[model samples]
Target: MSLMLGYLEDYAKNRRGSHNYHTILVMGYAVAGKPEFALQLFGRMRYQGIDLDVFAYHVLLNALVEGNYYDGVEAVSNQIKSRGFESEVTHSILIKSFCRKKEFDRAETYLRRVMEGEVKIKGGGYIVGALVDGLCKDEQFDRAGKLVDEFGEFHVYDIWIRELVRARKLDGAMEFLHKTRNVVQYVPDLFRYNTLIIRLLRENRLEEVCDLIIEMRESNIPPDELTMNTVLCFFCKGGMVDIALRLYDSRGQIGLSLSSMAFNYLMNTLCGDGSVVDAYRILKNALEQGYFPGVPTFSVLAHALCKLEKLDMMNELFHVALENNVVLSDRIHEIYIQALCRTGRVEDGYYIHGELNRLNKVTTGCAYNSLINGFIKSNRADIAVRLLIEMQEKGHTPSRQLFRTVIQSVCETENPEKQFQRLLEMQLSLHEIDCGVFNIFIEGAGLAKKPDLANEVYQMMKRSGISPNVTSDILLLRSYLRGEKVSDGLHFFHNILERRAIGRKVFNTLIIGLCKANKPDIALSYFTNIRAKEKTVRPSLECYEELIYVLCNHKRYDKILDVIDDLIDVGRPLSSFIGNNLLLHSLKDRELYDTWVDSRPPTELTQPESSHIWRLREVVGLFSDRFRDDISIDDLEQVVRNCFPLDIYTYNMLLRKLCAKQVDDADKLFDTLCPKGYEPNQWTYETMVHGFYKHGRKDHAKLLLKEMVQRGFRPSEVTSALL
Candidate 1:
C-alpha cells in the first residue's frame, strides 16, 4: 500500500502528463481506493495545460459512474464540452454511464439518439445487463422486466432474472419468469433454486420451502449442492436438525457431489445450533478433502463461540478469517462486543470496537449499543456519554432504542435533575433533542421539582414541529402538580379535551388527579363532561374508587349517597375503608345519625350485613354515655368483633377515641390491649395523655408521655402544650 501511494505521489507531480498517463494514473488511484486523490489528479492535470482525450475522459467518467457521483459526471461532461472531443465513444460512454448511474431519463435520451443513427454504441448484452441491473436497483422493476422480456431468448436472460432476485424483486422476477415460460434456456438452475430457497428461509416460510423443493423434483430439476445447502440452512434455523441430516444423507442417492460451499453451509447450520463440535469435525474433513471454507464461512463459528461464551475460540476464528482474507461482517463484531459486555469486560468491548473502526469495519450499531448500555450498567455515565459523542462524530446516528436506553439510565441516576440537565444540554448542542428525548428529561424534571425546565423543553418541541404524545402531556401535568400549580394542570387538561385531543387514558388521568388533589367537585364536573362528549365511555373501577375517596373526604354526604346508588347498580365491590370513614364522619353521634337517617330513604342504608354499617354502629357505641346503661356491653363487643376487622390504624383510631371518653374503663381496656401488640400511634398517645390532663389525672398523663417517647411516638406541639 505504501509503495502504491509513493507511485501515486510521483505520478501526480507530472503536470504535463499525456492522456494515456492520465488514464493509467487515475485508474491506479481508484484501484488504491483513493477516489478523492483521483479527482485532485484530474484537476491538477487540467491546471497544467494537459488536454484530456476521449480515453482520459472515459477513465474519469467511469470513476464518477461507479462511485455514484452524478454531479461529478456532469462536471466531467462540461469539461469535455469545453474541449472538442464530442465523438461516438464519448456519447456511448455517457449513455452507458447514465444507465449505470440510474439516470434513466438521460440514458433514454442517448439510447434514442443512438437508435436514430445520430450516435453509435457497442451494443451487446453487457450494456443491456447494466441497464437492467440499474433499473432494478432503482426499483423500476417494470422497465427491467420489459427489457428481460424483450431479450427473453438471449443466453444472458437468466442473468437478468438473478439481478431481479438480487434486488429483492421476487414477485416481479417470478412474474417475468412465468411470462417467459417458452424460454427453455431460462430453465430453473442451481443459482435460481438457491436464491429462492434462501429467500424463503429468510422469510421463515419453512413450510412453503418444502413445497418449492418438491415442485423442483417433479419438474425433473435435481437439487444441486447449493440447493441442498439452502435447505440445510432452513432446517438449522428452524431447529429441525434431524430432518436436515436426513436430507444430507440422501444427497448421495441423488448423485449430488458436495462442494466446500455445501460443507460450509452445513457447518454454519450446525454451529448456530450449539453443535460446535460437529461443525469443527465437518470443517476439518472438508479441509482434508481439499475444500476450503470461504470468508463468509467463519462468521457462524465466531458468532456461535460468542453464544457459548467461548471468547478465546471466537478470537481464534476471527484471526483465522483475517489470515484467510475473509472479511467479517459487522454482525460478527457485534456478537463479540456483546459477549464482552455481558461478561462485565466493558473496557475490552470498547477496545475491540476501536480496533474494528481502525480496520474500516465499524458498521456495528449493536456493538455501540452494548458499549453504551454496559457503561450505564457499570455506573460509568461519563464514558457512555463520550462514546455517544464519538459515535456522532464517526457519522453513525444513534438509533431510537439507544436514546431510550440512555434516557432510562440517566433518569434512574440519584440526582435525576442534574443528570437530565446535562443530557438536555448535550442533546441541544448536537441538535439531537426530540419529543421522546425531551419527555424523559421532563419526567426527571418533574421528579426533581423543576417544572421550569420541563416547560422550556415543551416549548422547544413545539417550535421544532414535534407533536407531543400522551406521555408528554402526562409529564407536563405532573410537572404542574409537583410545582403546586394545580390550576395550570386543570386548565391544560380542559384545553386538551376541548380541542378533541382526548384519549381514554388522558380522561382517566384528569379524573384521578383532580380527586387526589381534593377537588371532588372539579373531578365530578370533568367526569360529567366526558360522559356528555363520549357517551360510550364505560366507567372503570379506578374512576369509581377515586370518586368514592373524593366524596368521603369533602363530606359530600348527598353525593356519597348518589355514588353508592350507582355503585350498587354497577355491582362492583365496595371499598370498606372509605365506607367506614364516611359513615363514621357522617354519624358523629346520635343527633347527627338521626339527621342522616331522616334524610336518606330507609332502603338506601339497609346493607345491615356489611362491615361498614357495623363499624358505624361500633363507633356510635363508643359514646356510651349518649346511650343509656340499657345498651348491652355484649352487643357492643359483638359489633366491634363482627362489624370491623382490626388493623393498625383501626386499633389506633378506636383506642384514641376511647381515651377521649375520659372513662376509667377506657384505661383498663388500653392496659389489656397494650400487651397484644396493639401499640398505639402518635395520635393515640397524644389523645390518651391529653385526656388524662383534661380530667385532672396528671400522674397518668406523665406515665403516658414517658411511654410515648420510649415507643418512638413523637407527639405534636398541641399534645406537648397540654403536657
Candidate 2:
C-alpha cells in the first residue's frame, strides 16, 4: 500500500493531468481495503487545485461506502451532483450501501430518482439485482417481483424463482416463467431449472420433476452433480433409500463424479427419516471411500439418535464431527440441545450449550429460548429466569412467549407482589411495557382479587403512554366495585360514560352492584343523570327497576315521583312491576300519597283555576264512604259539574274509584262526561267494564270489552280479568 501511494505521489509531481491519475490511484487504494488512504488522496488532490472529474467522485463514493462512512457518502454524492457529473456507478454504489443497511425503501426511492433522470444504469442491472436480492432475503418477494417487472430485467429472475419456491408458490413461479418465455422470448438458464427441480423433488412432486427433466433434455440442458445430490437427499428423506442408492450407483454411469456433499445429503436425509442405522452404514461407506460427512450431517444423526433415546450413539457422532473440523450451525446445535432436554437430559443440554457459547455460536435469542423453555417445562423456572437475564445481558431481546412462560411460573409462587415485580422487570427488560402487557397484569390482579394491584397496573399503563381501551376501563370498574370502593367505582363510571366507553353489560353490573351495596340513592342519581343527558348512557330497564325498588324501600318518595315523571316525559311506560309497587304504597299511605300528589308543579295542572282538580280531590275524599252506601245520581251530577272540562285521565281515575264502591251513579257520571265533548278512550271503556262487572252486569261488561278490542286496544291484565 505504501509503495502504491509513493508511486502516485511521484507521478503527480512529474505528470500533467495528475488529478485523473490520482483518482485512478484512489480507486486502487479503495479496492485494496485502504479506504482511509483513498480519502486522504482525495483530500490532497482537492488541496492541490486538481480538477476532480466524475471518476474521482465515483471512486471516493466507493471508498466512503467501503469504510461504512454513510455521512461521507452523502457529502460525496452532493458534490457529484453539484459538479453535474452523471455517474450511474456512483448511484449504484449509494443504492448498494442503502440496501446493505436494510434501508430498502430509501434504496428504491433513490433508484426511482435515477431512472426518472434518464441515467442508464450500468453493469447489466447490478443496482436492481442487489435490491432484488435484498428484498428476497427479507421475504419481500412481491415487491421484488414488481421491481423486476417494471425494469423488464431478468438479472434477478433467479432470485425471484428461488424465493417463490421457498414460499411454496412453485406453480405461480412456473407460470411466470412460461409467460416470460412467450412475451419476452426469454429462456431460463440451467441453474434456474435446477432450482425448480430440487424444490419439486423436496415437495415430492415427482410428476412435475419428470416433466421438467424431459423438457430440460429436449432443450439440451442436463442435470448437474448438485441436481443428482438434491434428488438423492429428497428420496432418502422421503423413506425411499432403495431408490436413493440406485441413483448414487448410477451417477458414474451418467458421467457424474461422487461429491462429499452428496454423501452428506444422503446421510442427513436418512437420519432425519429415522433410519439412523442405515445412515450410519452410509457414513462408514463414505469414510472408507475417503469422503467424510460435515457437521450438519452429524448433527442430524445426533438429533435423531437422541430422539430415539440413544444418547451414547449421539455422543460418538458429535465427537466424530468435531474431529472432522466440521462446524455446526446454530440451528443444528439448538436442535441437539432441545432433543436432550426433552429426554430429561437437561444437564447434558446445558453442557452442549456451554460448548456452543465457547465456540461463539450461541448469539441468537432462539438458542436461549430453547433452553429456557426446556427448563420451564422441567419446572426449573429459576434457572430459566437466570438464563433470561444472561440472554438480555448478551444484547438479545427476550421474546414475548419467553416472558409469558416466566410470568406464569412466577404467578404460581407464594408472593403475589413478587409475581407483579417480575412481570414488570420483564417488560422493562424487553422494552415492551405497553398497554397490552400491563393489561395482562391488571386482569391477573382482578382474578386474584387484588384491586389495589389492578389499579397500580392501570396507572402504570397510562404513564407508559398507552391509552386504556374499553376492556381496561371495564376491568378497573369491576375491580373497584368488587372492592366495595363505591366512590371510586362511581367516579370511573362517570368518566367512562362520558367517553362512551362503557357498554350495557358493564353499566348494568355497576348499577346492580350499587343497589346491592344499599346505595340506591347514588344509583338513582346516575340513572337520572344518564337519562337527562342526550347521547349519554341509557341504563337498561332492569337497572331502572332496581333503582325504583330500592328508592321506594328506603322511602325516598320525592325521587320516586321524579323518576316516574321522567319515564312519562320520555313516552316510556312504567314497568308493571314498578307501577304496581307505587300503587300499593299510595293506597297503604294515603296521607303521604296526598302530599306527593300536591307537590306536582302547577304546569302539570294545565289550568290551576280549572274545577277538575277540586272535583278529583272531592271524589277521592268520598272514596271512603261510597262503599258503605249507594250514592244518588243528583250528587254525582253535582260532582261532574265541579269537574267540568275534565281530561280523560282524571275521568278514568274518577270512574276507577266509583267502580270500587257500590255507587249506582257511576254509570250516569260516565254518560254525562262522554256527552260533554269528551272522547272515550281505551281507559274509559276499561273503567266502565270494571264498574259493570262489580255491579254483576256481566253482559254489559262483555259488550264494553268487545268494543275496546274493536278499537284496536289490548286490555290490561286487570281489565281482562274483570271481563
Candidate 3:
C-alpha cells in the first residue's frame, strides 16, 4: 500500500496533475480505508474547484462509516444526499452505518423503508447480512436468528452460521444447520463445515467431527483444501490409520496439498503407531510437497528408524534434516551416533561428533561411550584415548569400566607408551594440577597392566608440586600388585612403612590385591600383621571376602575357618559373596563342613555375635537337606533372606543346593525368585539346566537351554555337557 501511494505521488509530480489523478487519489484513499486522509483529499479537491462524482462521493461516505467516524458520516451523508447521489448503494451504506453504531433496530427500520421503495434493489441479501452480523456481534443471537429466519436469504444464512461458529457457539450453529436441513436450495458452504470440524478436531471431539464430515459427504458439498487437510489430521488423531492412508494415497486424484501443521501431526502419529515404513514414505512425500515437518516429528521418526536399525533410511533422513537446517536434539544425535557405531559406521559417527564439537553441541557421556568404544573396535585406540581425555575436559566423567576399556585398547596399539604419555599429558594440561588427575592416569595405567607407566605418572604428580593424596598412593601400590610385580609392591610398602604412612586403607589394599594375585601367603601375612600391631584397625569386609575366596579356591578350609573367626571378630555381617562362596565350596568339599564344626570353640559359641558362625553351619546343613525341619521351597528363600541379602550369585547358590537332589523344588524356586526383583544370569540358567539334567528330565533341560539362549545367554561347558 505504501509503495502504491509513493508511485501515485510520483506520477502526480512528474505530470502536471489532472482532475482524473485528483479523483483517483480521493477514491484510492477512501477505498484504502484511510478516511481521514481521504476526507482531507476531498477538501483539497473542492478547494481546487473539482467535485466528486457519485461513485467517489459514495465511496468516501462508506469509508467514513467503516472507519466509525460518525460525525464525518453525518456530514458526508448530508452532502451526498443534497447532491442527489442517493441510490440502493446509498441506502445500503446508510443501513450498514446504523448497524456499525450497534443501532440494529434503526437498521431494520431503514431496511424496511428501502424494501418499500420502488427502486427494487438487486441482491438485497447483503443489506440483511450486515444487520445479522451486527446483531450476532452484539451477542443477540436470538434476534439474529429471528432476522435470518424472517429474511430467509442465502447470504444471511451463511453470515449467521459463520458468525455463530466464530463466536464458539458450535452447538447453536449445528442446531441451526439441523433446522435448515430440509435439502432446500440454501445450505451452509464447506467453509462453515471446515471451521466447525477444525475446531472440533482441536477439542478432540472426534464423534462430532466425524458426524460433520459425514454430513459434508451426504450434502454433496465439495470439500476444499482446508477440509481435506483437517480430515487427514483428524484420521491421524483418531487413530484411524487405514482411512488416513486411503485418503492420503489418493492425494493426486483428489488434488490434496498438505499444510505444515497437518504434515507434522501425520508424521508424529505414524511413528507413534509403529508404522515407520509408512512414516518414511510420508516424510519423503511431504518433503516433495515442500512441507517440512516440525523438529519434534523429525526426532520422533529419527528415533523410530534408529531403533529398528533401518540405518540406510536413517542416514538419509539425518542428512535431510541437516540440509533443511533442522536443529536435531542432543538425544537424537546421541542415538543416531550410537546406531551408526553399532552398524560399523564409526567414521561417519566420528564425523558427526566432530561437527557437534565444532558447533558446541552437548556431546553426552553415552555418545562418547559409543564413539570411544567404537574407535577401540576399529583399531583407533589413539583416538579413543584422546576422546576419553577430551570427554573429561567437556565435564563428562568416564566410568572406571570405560577407562579400563580405553586403556586396554591403548595397550594393544603400536607404541603404547607414546599413546599413553600423550593422553596423560592432554589430561594433565587440560585439568588443574591435582592428585585426582594423576590418580586417573595411574588407575588407567594400572588397569592396562602398565605398572611402569603408573609409577611414572605418580612421580610426575610429585614433580608437578602436587602432594599425592591417599587414593593416589593406593592406586600406585595396586598397579604394582596388579602387574604381578609383588617385589615392587613390597618395595613401595616398605617405603610407606618407613615414612609412617602405612595405615588401615593402605593395609586393606595390600591384603586385597595380594589375595587377588594368588599370593595368599603375603596377603595373610599383612592381614595378621595389621591385626597384631594396629589392634583397633581391622580389614574391610571386601578384604576378608577376597582372602576367603582365594583360600577356598586353594581348598584351605582350616585357614578359611580362621578368616571367618576374624570376620566375626570384626563385627561385620557376612556379605553375600562371602557367604555364597563358603556355602558353594562346602557343598563340593565335605571337609569344609567338618573344619567349621571342628574349629568353632565351645566357649566361642557363647560370645557376642558368634551366632553368625552358627548360622553359616546351619545353612550348610540345610543345603544338604539334613536340617531337622523339612523346609518348603517357600521357606527356603525367606530362610536365606534371614541370613544374608540375596544377589544373583546367592540365588545361584540356592539353586545349586536343590539342583542335584530336589530338581522340581529348584525349578519352582527359579520361577518364584524372578518376580521378587531378581534377574537370572548365565550361571542361574546353568544351575537349573544341571538340576533338570540330574533328575533325568532331559526335556526340561533342553527347554531351559533354549530359553537361556533366547535371553542372550549361552550355556556354559557344564550346562552344555548336561544337555
Candidate 4:
C-alpha cells in the first residue's frame, strides 16, 4: 500500500503525465485509512507548482474529514482559494468541515461564494449534496432549497435533495428541486433511489414515496438489494407485515437475499414496537432461506417474548442465538431470566443466574441490578435481599442502585423506617453508605409522608460524611411541605439553595406546595424575593406558565401581565394549549398585549418567531409523495398559470408534465409560449421528446424527429434515443 502510495506521490509531483497522479496518491491514502499521510503528501506536492485538481482535492478532503484532522482542512481550502480555483470539490470540502464542526454558517458562506465564482471545477451532485446536508443539519431550510435550485443542473441533486427532504428538510431542499420539473435522473441507479426512499420511510412519509419497483420498471433501471431493503424497511416501519412477507412472493423473480443487517434492523424496529409476531414471521422467512439469524435479531426477539410473557418463546430465541453461533449479551440473558420469572418461572431465572455465577460472568453490577429489579417487581423482596448478600459474599460490593431497589422493596412489605434503620445499622457494620443511598431513603420517607424519618435520613447522611444532593434536600423539603410545616420547608429550601444551589425545578416544586396549602401570598412573596436576588436565575417556561395558570385561577389577572412580560422578554411564545387559554385571559385585560408583545426589552422584538412548525410543513410538502401522482391536464394548466407565471423552472416542470401527457402538443405549447411573449429553447423540445420516448409514444416521437430534421437541429444521443 505504501509503495502504491509512493508511486502516486511521485507521479503527482512529476507533472509530466496526462494521468491525474495526485488524485491516485490521495485515493491510495484515503483507501488505506491514512488520510493524514495523504494531506502531508498534498502539502509537499503544493510546493512543486502542480495544481491539485478536483479529484485530488476530494480524496484528500475526505481523508482529512475521515481521520478528523479539521484544522488542516482550512489550510488546504485557503490554498485552493488563493489559486482562485474554488472547484466543486473545494466547496464540498469546506462544507464538510463546517458540518463536522457544526459551524453551518461558514459552510453556507463558502457554498454561496462557490456559486458566485466562475467554474473552477464545474459543480456537481456532491457539492449540492454537501450544502443540503449542512443546511439540514443546521436547520436552515429556506437557503438550502434555493441552493439546490442553483446546483440542480445535474439530475444527481434530485436523489440527494429528496434524501434531505425525507430527512425533514423538505422546504429548503424543494425550493431548489421544484425549479427543475423534468424527471431528474429519476432512476439515479438503485443505491441513491433506495437511500432517498428509506429516509422518507424513516420520516414516516410513506404516502408520498412511490412504488419504487414500478418506478424502476418505467425508467428501465434494474433493482438491487438496496432497492429491495428500502421497500422492506418501509413495510416494517408501516406495520405492513403482509407486504414484508411479499419478499417470498418476489424472491424467485428478483433473486432476493435477505441481508442480515437489513433483517436485523427490521426485527429490532418491529420488536421495539411490540410486533414480535411480525418479527417471528420474518425470522421464519430467513430460516427458510437457510440463513442463520444474528445476535441482535435474537436479542430483540427475546425482549419481545419477555414483554408478551412468553417464556417458551424467550428460551427458543435464546437457543436460536446459540445455534446460529450468536453470542448472547448480558441484556439477553437478563431478559430471558426476567421473562421466566414473570410467568411464575423464578426457578428458571435463578437457574440462569446460577449458570452465570458458575461461569464467573456475574461480576458486573448491571446483571445483578436487572435480577433484583425483577424480584422487586415480582414482590419477592426477601429473595432480592438474599441475592444482595450473596453478591457481597462473592466480593462484589452492592451498588447504591441495588441497595435502593432492595430497600424500597423491603419498605413496601414492612415498616420502612425500621427497615431503613436496620440498613443504617448494617452499613455501620460494613463500609459507609453512599450519598445516593441516603438520598433514596430520604425520597422513600418523603413519599410515605414521614417527615421525621426523612429528616433522620438527612442527619444520617451528614454524619456519614456523605453530603445530601439537591434531590435529597428537595425530598426533605417536600416532606415538610406535605405536612404543612412551612417554616421547616422554607428553612430547608434556603439551606439547599445556599449549599447545593438547587435550580428552578426544585424551587418550582416548593412554591407549588405553598400554593396548594392556600399560601399564595407567601408563595408570591418567595417568588418576588428569589427573582430580586438571582439576576441570572429565572423561571423555566413551564414554571412561568404554571404560575400564570395559578394566578389566573385565583382571578389574580393583574399579576399575570408581569409573568407574560417575562415570558416575552425571554423569547418564549406560549405553547398552542397555553396560547388558546392566554388569548381568552387577555380578552379581560386591555393591557395584555402591552405586556405580552410590547415588553420592557426592545431586544426581545429582535427574536425570531419559532419557525419550527412552518418549516416542518414546508419540508413535508417538498418531499411529499403527492408530486408522483398523475396530474390532470387542467391541474397542469392551473399550475402553469399560478406557479409558472414568474418561475422558469416551474414553467418548465409544468411544460414537462403537460408534454408528458400529450407529446404532439409540443408545437402547440411552443406556439402558446410565443404568444405569451416567452421564447422556447432546446430544453422545451428536449423535454417533450424525452417525455414522448419515456411513455413509448413512437408516433409522437417520429413527429418530433421529423420536426427536428426540418429545422436543421441534429439529435444528440439522448434525443436520438428518444426518437
Taking all chains together, each candidate's TM-score versus the true structure is: 0.37, 0.33, 0.73, 0.37
lDDT of each: 0.68, 0.70, 0.82, 0.64
How do the residues 445-534 of candidate 2 rate in per-residue lDDT, one tens digit apiece? 655456677788898788878899877887777777666788888888878878875566677777766876689777877666656664
Worst 10 residues of 2 by lDDT: 619-628
Name model 2 segments beyond 4 Å from true: 1-262, 284-291, 299-325, 338-348, 393-402, 419-423, 426-453, 459-723
Per-residue C-alpha lDDT of model 1 across residues 1-723, encoded as one tens digit per residue = 679988877876774445468767777776676666677778877787765667677677767766767677788877886776555455655766787756798776555555456444445445455566667677787787676666444434666778766777666666666555544534667567678778767867777678667767877887776777667766766778767766766776876556665566577778767878666656655666677777666777777878888876676666666666677888888889999999998998888787777778764666788899899899887678778767876778887666656655665667765766677778777766567677866765666556666777787778879888778898877776666677988887776666565776777677777777778998887787776777556566677778877776666655655555555555545554644464345335344344345566766456565645434534444543345443333354455556445554554445444555534655665675668677667766776787788779999999989999999888788877777
Using lDDT as the measure, the top candidate is 3
Whose TM-score is greatest here?
3
Which tens-of-lDDT digit does each residue in 1-723 have in candidate 3?
777677667866775565477778777877766789888878887888888899989898999998998888888788888988777677778878898887888999988887777877776788788888888888998888888888777888899889988888888887878878874446678777888888777767777876876677687876778888988888898898877877788878767887777777778888888888999999998888787788888899999988887878888998898799887899999999999999999998888898788778878999999999999999999789878888987899889788777876786677988887777777668767788777877887898788998899999888989888888888989999999999999899888787665678898889999998999877887788778888878788999999999998988888888888788887988889988887788668677777666777787556554366666777766764556545677677766776678898888888888776677788888997779788999999988887777788899989989999999997778677656
Better of 1 and 3 by lDDT: 3
Superposed Cα deviation of residue 360, candidate 3 (Å): 9.3
Backbone clash total for model 2 is 0
Clashing pairs in 3: none
lDDT, residue 101, model 4: 85
TM-score computed on alpha carbons, candidate 1? 0.37
Quote the positional error of residue 578 for candidate 3 in Å. Answer: 1.9
The order by descending lDDT is: 3, 2, 1, 4
